[model samples]
Target: MSDTALGKDRRFPFGLTIATLIAFAILIGLGAWQIKRLAWKQDLLARIEVLKTAPAQPLATALANAQGRDLTWTRVSVDCAPAQPATLPLVYGIRDGDIVWRATALCRATVGGYGAVLLDLGVVKALTGQSAPAPVALAAPARAVGVLMAPRQLGGDREATVQKFAAERPAPYILMVETATPVPPGVTPAPLPAEISNRHLEYALTWFGLAVTLLFIYAAMLWRKMRS
Candidate 1:
């Protein structure tokens, strides 16, 4: 054999091939994981849609029975006006800071007195100054539509959320307001950010494409060496 033949054929880089294969494996694994996540997310979305359309029951009823029970597929209603800005803080957020938000507090329906109240039924863009003072007469009664979420009752847990309004009720998270419309005293509606993050699907497809390319390249390299 010639001196050059005995020498390593740099073109057939075994170490480089091994490293590329490892990288390919990791990317392929990540792509597979993303696919699994997509399945899980779809199921969750379906569950939420079902909950949205379920029959609307009384908040008090749902609370009494649904509390500590399986509440995945239940719904309810609450009636109460947003507490005054002083008492029930109409909390709102600005680009810089947040102040009391406009509210359509839900009070449990009755002849008189307050009933399960969830405030802030109106929407307002914060102003430049210190949490611009809300309209003194912003009495928009919001007939908000939402899911009968488990009330967020305060407890001893350190990480638990504490409400600024009346003392903690059964479940601290009273309800997850799903829909809202403007009434006379409209409370500030909660901002609902989008749930779809499509980039993962794109990345997963990319990794799969790269893995396919690697397979072809490996085969082509082997064929060329055999031909030589």
Candidate 2:
């Protein structure tokens, strides 16, 4: 047998070493990616903190100022008249550890910047396999004081209902109602979450720790091979 083959077979695990190197590279890459994610998440949380507490602006002014910028979590006020109650959509969600449907509707904004805006009126609770609650009637021409948020993806049926209002060219953001004059019946205004978890740093540390552990394991295997 050749010297190289004999050496690989008796003294070194060439194939195993190559596999370990590949796995180590993958683990390190994952760790680095997580670090980048950690930075991004931190920045987002910081921005949200500042925007949520600043004085509320008019919806039109907020939209204009937010041009080419993120407007999520910006408190805004608008005079909106809810569309027909029967056509409103119910988006599925969880609130207070119970299943609930978020009541959503397209409202005609009096401001000129946007023809219409989407509103999250509140939540309606119902159990699984139960029929949805009756649609609540929102008082007309409400002064909606709320924070603007980016819309989340919806299920097919609910998405279809929202699309029905697309012709109105509603603002891209949804106003999560904090308060409105003459509130809609049987609905609770669900605003921005009280706390947004920032666990990216912890996740990044875990990924890095795993990478170091892999290196130690690889080194131990080589040590055993050399000793033998």
Candidate 3:
């Protein structure tokens, strides 16, 4: 066959090749990122499991020991004076398969010199039709034992929430009250999550599988072009 006719029969798939290479790189990059995520998730899960059973420490001691480290899931105890009625922020949430509101308050910490701490009093079942329940008073001081959790952004209004519950300088972590003496009225403490899902490995495999499949398809296309 003449060179001109041969070229027409088997023109290089330049555009298709470029597109395929870009897609393959993206898939591979995604897979690598997922692998890194998998490692991080595994470490977090392990830390949570250990923290769940560790004996509770005084909140002041825990804070001192943390030294700027992540305090999430660490169990601690604190004594809290009753919070002001207006400072309570009812965060929307779900618990035990029911729509509920998480009752939170900023209270004076008798120990740790924390000045104040945000206490998650617990879940208040949403009224019929998922309406928010009426706010209630926190009238009793309590000795609370709970896990310290990072404050969740309430609809991106974390700054507003902080300002609403103003204190000398509030504790950075929220104390999710597990047990308290003279429990606050009309609110149940939310339970720790029963399980945290770890699916990064599966996601990594999926991305990698797509990249390999693309390579196979590209090779087949190249074979057909060469034969033609």
Backbone clash count, each prediction separately: 40, 0, 1
Q: For model 2, state the Cα shift of residue 61 in Å.
A: 1.3
Over the stretch 1-228, how does candidate 2's per-residue lDDT look in tens digits? 787866765676778889878887887787788789878878877876796678888999988877588787788888866455544666766555666777776678855466888778777543322356554544433677888777653333544554677788778777888887667766678776646677766777787788788888988988877765
Better of 2 and 3 by TM-score: 3
Question: Which one is best on TM-score?
Answer: 3
**Can you give the TM-score per candidate against the true fold?**
0.54, 0.81, 0.85
With a 3 Å backbone cut-off (N, CA, C), the pairs that clash in candidate 3 are 122-188
Q: Mark the regions of model 3 whose C-alpha exceeds 4 Å error after superposition.
A: 1-5, 82-87, 110-113, 126-129, 139-141, 152-159
Report the lDDT of model 1 for residue 140.
Answer: 21
RMSD of 2: 3.5
- Per-residue lDDT over 1-228 for candidate 1, one digit per residue giving the tens place of the 0 to 100 score: 575874544357687689878988987998998898778767767766786557777656665664367553345556545443333334333322444343334343431132344433444445224455544444323354555332332112211222433452323343445554444333334423235344667778988998888888888886776556
lDDT at residue 145 of model 1 (Cα atoms): 52
lDDT of each: 0.50, 0.71, 0.76
Candidate 3 backbone overlaps, count: 1
